[model samples]
Structure formats: structure tokens, C-alpha cells
Target: MTSTGSTIEPPTTRAMVGASVDQPDAGIARRRWMSVLKHAGLIALSVVMVYPLIWLVVSSFKPNEKIFSDLSIFTGDLTFENYLHGWTSQQLPFSVFLVNSSILVLGAIVGNLISCSLAAYAFARLRFWGRNAFFAIMLGTIMLPFHVVLVPQFVIFRELGWLETFLPLIVPKFLAADAFFIFLMVQFIRGLPKEIFEAARIDGAGQFRIYSQITLPLMVPALATTAIFTFIWTWGDFFGPLIYLRTRENFPVSIALKGFVDAQSSSDYGAMFAMSVVSLIPLFLAFLIGQRYLIKGFATTGIK
Candidate 1:
């Protein structure tokens, strides 16, 4: 104080220590609460979305009278009678429809993989006159709705004597009828390194040799994706079969499921629900088996 002096604040080590200790605790507490809230929200949404499917599965085991009377998912009484009756309730065994759907799906998968991939390869790798014009036209077809061509296609198939047959359903796939799949594969093929194709050309490899040996092997992700989607779409197709197939024997599961309903009499709700569950099995299995490839395909092809 005797000399010229300025005031100096004392260091509060206690306050600094308290703040440093409290900050970490506050941040960790906030993050933990946020995580808990996020998980709880997800679980709630999942329950809401899955409730209907659970109800359907439960109703399939209940007698028709009890289905509407008791809305609860659980009951003291349950029966397997619906499944037994549903398997044989129609004119033909349910197995017949399953087989028909399986055959159609198989054909569609093979056709899309072969024809669409080839078309995509040509559009992506091969050079020709008016290539861009042709590609533009193909993409334009993707924007066209299926219903716009339904009547014309029906007339053409009838003229070709393909009505009431699986030919109408399966043959179009062989002709690269699905433009969306072709587009998908084209994008995937374009992503491949061009150097490899040039090297193969230098080795005197023909287009077919290049496609079979080099391109096809690397296109597994795209091919598997195509197959899985083809199976799902063709298996669940009801309208196509309904228009062309008049005979019950030729009906796929999608159409045969309609047999459970009778306009003049009471509908077999229990059996219908049972068969509906059965129809979903193949779709579930296909997804589960090929989900990895599906994810990979989307990632490589830049499709969301």
C-alpha cells in the first residue's frame, strides 16, 4: 500500500474445481436422458405399426364367431381349425396356388436377370447409332403408368391366343418389359471401371465373352436385387392373373385367395386370414435371404 499499487484478485481454485467437476456430469446426464427418450419413442412407434399384423395373426387362430366379438389379441380358447380348413376349403388344394405362384415368380426372376441385364449392358457399354435416343425412350417408358397400356396389352394377348394362360404373365418379362429394372442395372454397370473393359477388348474378347466372364460375376448385387424384387412383385400380382386367367386351376395364390369370399353366402374370414398369413411366408423368406445383397445393390448403384 505504501508504493504505487494496483488491486489483484485472488485465484478461486475452489470455484474452478467445482465447475470442471460439474460440466462432465451435466453433459453425460443430458446424453443419457436423450438416448432413453429416443429409444422409448422408437419402441412406441414400432408397437403401433406392428399392432395390425399381430391382430391378423391372432384372429387367424380364433373361430369366426369370436373374431369380431372379442377384439382382444389374447383368449383362453384357440384353435388350428382355420388353417386346416383353409388348406382344403377351395376347389383345389392351397398347394396348387402356391405352386403356380412359385413357377411364375421363378420364370420372372430368370427372365429379368437375363433380358434386363443384357439390355442394360448394351445401353451402358456398347456404342451404336442413336444410342442416346434409345436410352431416353427406355427411361420415358418408366414414367408411363401400367394402366395406360393395360387394355392394349389385353387385346394383343387375346389376339395371340395367350389369354387364360401363364404365357401372358411370364413372356413379357423375357422381352425386357420391365424398364425400371433395366435402368437400375444400367446405372450399376456404368459405375464399373472402364479400364477393365478396355483391357478385355485388347485381349480380343468379344462382347459376349466380356459380359459372361467379367460383367456378370461383378453384377451379383444387382442380379440378386432384381431376383428378390421380381419374386415379390410377381408372387403378389393379382390383377394380371385375374385378367388373363379364367380357370381356377391356373390361378395364382393372389387370385385364388378371393375364393374364400362368397357374395351369396357368408365369407370364410377365418380361413382367408389363415391363407393370407401363409401367402406372406415366401415374401418374408425372400427378403431375409437377400437383404444383404439388396443393401449392397442400392449402395453401389446410388439408389436410395
Candidate 2:
């Protein structure tokens, strides 16, 4: 009712105020419910994933006769005799296997860090003829499954007289045979600021100097990630040692664990389980130690 006699509607400030207040509350409630569901689902998945490891550890403590029979993880029939028997029953002591595996993993960590990082640096930063083509070819090799070249690699190693030694297991790692680590490092390297390398170059620093000083220090997260994975892979590599190692004395823990298993004869389940648990210690320690770095690498690369 203005002086011009035109009808007008006033703004609903009360309704607007109510809506503004209520929408956030509704959104918050919805988000809270979603978060609850997400957390619950994650907890359930965690239990499911962890149950097998818990079962393995529990079975290690139980006697062979009671392992399958005792469904409960909290079985009262627990003993340390499995560890005693497992440690002593093999032709070579478990400590020998432990030492061999440790050496193998350490060698692999060093090899992958040196070889993969160098390859990644060359691909990511250095200029070279057919760089893109070479990178594409390198990436293409990942599509070629390991089984495809398994026989050829075996024959080559046999011809090179590396078949019966740790050389077969450790040498190719030094040659950057693992494309996965190279790709991972390349991703990490690509994320690094190129200005650092530029500044280093301006100061008359060589490629090696830039790599060692600028790149390597920043690539610690990626390298730790590589080390963790390399250790785990090398440690659990049953097939490699099985094929190359003839003597039981030189066998790593993966191969040594098979001593407890005789398909034709009575298998010592308790001992096998105990040794299996023991074998996982290095992997557990590796992941635990490098978990922060692993997270950092993945977070930076936006890859898991």
C-alpha cells in the first residue's frame, strides 16, 4: 500500500533467518551421519583384514593338533615350543635364513634406491635423445608381465652362471629391472620444483651434484617408500630363492619356511605358522618405520 497504490510484499526476514540457521544444522547432521557410516565401514573392513593376521599369530602359539579344531583366537592352548622347534628343526638354523634374508633385503634397498632414482631423474629432469620415446617404451614394459620373461631371465641367469647364487636374486635389481619403483620415483621427482635444479645449474653444479644435493634430499619420502616396498618384496620372494638357490644353507627365510612343509609327509603346522609369523617381523618393522614417509609420498603423488 504505497502512495501509488501498488500492492507490495515485504521480505520474509524471519523465514530467511530460520532457513539460514536450519540449513547448516541439517547439513551438519547429514555430514555427521555420513561420517559415522564411513568410520563404521572402515572399522569393519579393518577387522576383516586384520583377522587373518590375528589368526596366524594365534595359530603360531597353538599346537598342530588343536589349530583347526580351536576356532577361537583366544585358545587357552598356547605354547612357545613352536618357536623352539621351528628355530631348531631345519637343517640350517633359522638365524642363518634371517641373516641371508636381511642381506638380500638390504642389497635390494640399496640397489632400487640407486638404480630407480637415477632412472627416474634421467626421465623426469635430464634431456636426452628420444626421451619421450624411451619413457614410453619403459612404461610399455610394465604391460609385459613378469611371467612372460621369466623363462628367458632364467635361461640368461643360468648361462651367466648366476643360477645357484644370490646374484640372480640381487643383481638385476641394480640394473633397474623394476619399472614400478622407477615410475614411482618419476612421479615424486616431477612434483619437485625445477627452480632448485635451475639455481644449482646457475651455480655451475653438474647433473650429478644437482641429483645428489637437491633431488636426493627432497626425494627421501619417495626413497623410503621404495625401501619399504623393496624390503617387503625381497623378504617374501619365495619363488626367486626357490628357483636359484640349490643348497638349503644359502636359503632365505621364504625358502627356509618350506622346510617345515612336506606335502607327502606329516607337516609341522605349528612350526610353519611360528616361522611365518617370525618372517613377518621384518616387514612389520619396515612398514612401521617408513609409514610416515610412505604416507608423505602417496599424499604428494596423490596415489596409494
Candidate 2 similarity to native, TM-score: 0.85
Candidate 1 lDDT, tens digit per residue, 1-304? Answer: 2521111213563445335543546555766898999999999999999898888989999998898889899887889999999898877999999999999998999999999999999999999999999999998887887899999999999999999889999899999998878988998889899999999999999999999999999888888888988888899998899899989889899988877655317577788899988998898898799889777766755533
- The lDDT per prediction is 0.86, 0.85
Clashes of 2: 0
**Model 2 regions lying over 4 Å from their true place:** 1-38, 296-304
Shift of residue 260 alpha carbon in model 1, Å:
2.8
Q: Which candidate should be chosen as best, given lDDT against the real structure? A: 1
**CA lDDT, candidate 1, residue 298:** 62
